[model samples]
Target: MSGARQFTDRADAGDRLGETLRDRGVDADIVLAIPRGGLPLGRAVADALEAPLDVVVAKKIGAPGNPEYAVGAVASDGSVWRNERAIGGTRTDEGYFEERRKIEAENARRKAERYRGGRPAPDLAGKTVVVVDDGVATGSTLRACLSKLERSDADRIVLAVPVGPPGTIADLEAQVDEVVCLETPAGFRGVGQFYANFTQVSDEEAMAYLER
Candidate 1:
């Protein structure tokens, strides 16, 4: 990436991203943010688009012996996005992947239920949905969420983020109707590198953003 930081914080990044979406005349019926970090940005983006905000939950299926390395991801609705390259490189077996997928899918479903707090899931049929995230690296979780949306009756699906690597961005473009990424830095390391204050977001704080 550039030597200078791209954003002071997530809120700042969200403001810029929201502005960019507005300038592009992107219409959204609802904004679904990946919980925790994405909630803050989703708030700003929802406000900008004049739409309701909600969370689209997914959990990363980490590699064996290297839990931080994601081999795939599973969405709340059992939608999955597997990284064939990562699976092959990590030598993740079919049984292992299937077990993890079931576990993670249940985890994601529980999270979505908790985040929704008993409210019915959004009616996405024929509606334009925008999926927001703080940023992405491998984008496993995002791909899973997008997969869920793709299987839904949504009229259109848009993926929006603050920054990501070029290769990941290009791959994501094929999965959605449109992508609204503010920055795609060449020398990317991780999403936090582009922000000056990349603090962890709590579930409590994340849920608050959905309160309107």
Candidate 2:
């Protein structure tokens, strides 16, 4: 039998993650979630921890012919994380990266506006900040988000994801103060494969969760 269990959805995963964090003494001043996908999970965590929920957006820069192949990713504030191995071997051009960055930058801006509604980003000055995501596959996007958080005045930066591949988790541990992942499989294929009901999360649904 496979070791993997089930999560009804991202929210359920987040709820369990919150409890695990609490047990592990994950005390954060605020929870910033990567938007669209992570917002719902963030909501559950924020509610559990009684912390404010904020939004952070990351857009993946996929290689040509393989949209799922994230060679790199960019955060809302223009921080970029590239997989060196992917970049060195792939046929991706500088022009492709530039073009993708332009499109992703605009997409990030639009998401920020829609999600935050002109509200200023949370003041992380000297406060512990936990960045939550549903799961991570390539680790490019999570690295981008963590890189941007490092620039902030946060006292601590914790990356909380429900599931990830074992190798990805090890790499992430070298970057963040703490990495909270529920499952790390050696034969991990993708994040959705671990979930029972892994469905696309619409921006409207994300906003609705934030509104409440």
Candidate 3:
């Protein structure tokens, strides 16, 4: 299928992906979404599988002088996943990373509190966690999320997305137990390019999805 026709939005994509997993008898342990965009998609998957949905807040740490270029990402649990390759080579300074970490950590905390509403995170012990996102570009955020989840007591980690660059999907395959990506295009531009109605997901909307 063409990338243009793959998903109406993150929610629609999640529905189709959930159906596919059901067909394969993959009830993927627990649903974890990267808010705030991933929450709506997570809700659809949770409803489809009759599973619980929770948020995994991770902030991308962008390189100095280039906010769009991610050097790493940090999870809410204080887990930091760094791309050593991106460092030093891209003129990324030492003190800059430390500063970014502090700022991103605070941002992640606010997002967690806003969406979770003081709700305790689910115990991942002995459970298979399915991590969902609206889409992926460089996979930096997901890399950190999966790294954090791996340190947890979860049995397995499955990364799911509606669409992503082919290279990003390949890079994640080794890190995740399973990857359920609907579209991996070589000519990928951005996540929004693939969706017809890719509006920004508000924190309020994300909270409502979690409450459901």
Candidate 4:
């Protein structure tokens, strides 16, 4: 994906993603964005599709020594995705994984509540769901989110992201019903590098998207 237009920010990425989805006639009954960054994009997608926007929460389970490195992730309902390679490579103990999973799951649940604000969760049963994100890297969090959705009654699960690495996009294709990624460049490093104004989106700023 050469000469791709750099995203001005998360909102710009979301706008582009919305246009792509609309062009494909992607009809989503609901749009769920992973919080803190995905919200901006989710808002655009929901508006474009004329669907309701909501939050889907997940937290990374970092490795033992490298707290920044995600070994896996867990969703609000305790649905988990574990990176066996990361665990084995780092010799991450079972006790450590267990502890983090529990903690992260709880954290995810809390975040979801905060964003939704006592609103009952939208019924995914027999509904078309589009999970929007700014981008993807290792895809640990996304895998966990998909796993959680699989356990639900969602009729279809489509993942729509603005950009992602080719390898990660390939792997995720097997997990979801469909993938709509605008850019799948092999030269991907981090998600931030593709954006001209890739700023850190605070929880306060992220939550505002949900309110609107």
User: Can you tell me which runs of candidate 1 are displaced by over 4 Å?
Assistant: none
Per-residue lDDT of model 4, residues 1-212, tens digit only: 77444788888899999999999998899999997778899999999999999988889999988988888899999999999999999889999999999999999999899888899888899999999998999988888999999988999999999889999999999998999998898889888888888788898988888888
Question: Where's the lowest-lDDT run of ten residues in candidate 4?
Answer: 1-10
lDDT by residue (132-182, candidate 2, tens digit) is 989988778778888888888789998999999888899999988999998
lDDT of 1 by residue, 84-179 (tens): 999999999999999999999999999999999999999899999999999999899999999999988999999999999999999999999999
Give the top-scoring candidate (lDDT): 1
| Candidate 4 ranges with C-alpha deviation above 4 Å | 3-5
Estimate candidate 4's alpha-carbon lDDT, on a 0 to 1 scale: 0.91
- The ten-residue window of minimal lDDT in model 2 covers 1-10
Clash count list over all predictions: 1, 0, 0, 0
Scored against the true structure, residue 102 in model 2 reaches a CA lDDT of 76
Q: What local lDDT score does residue 153 receive in model 1, on the 0 to 100 scale?
A: 95
Q: List ranges where model 2 is wrong by over 4 Å.
A: none
Ten-residue stretch with the least lDDT total in model 3: 1-10
The parts of candidate 3 lying over 4 Å away from their true place are 1-5
TM-scores, one per candidate: 0.98, 0.92, 0.94, 0.97
lDDT of 3 by residue, 85-144 (tens): 887678788788888988887788787877788888788998988888999998887887
* Lowest summed lDDT window (length 10), candidate 1: 1-10
Clashing pairs in 1: 1-187
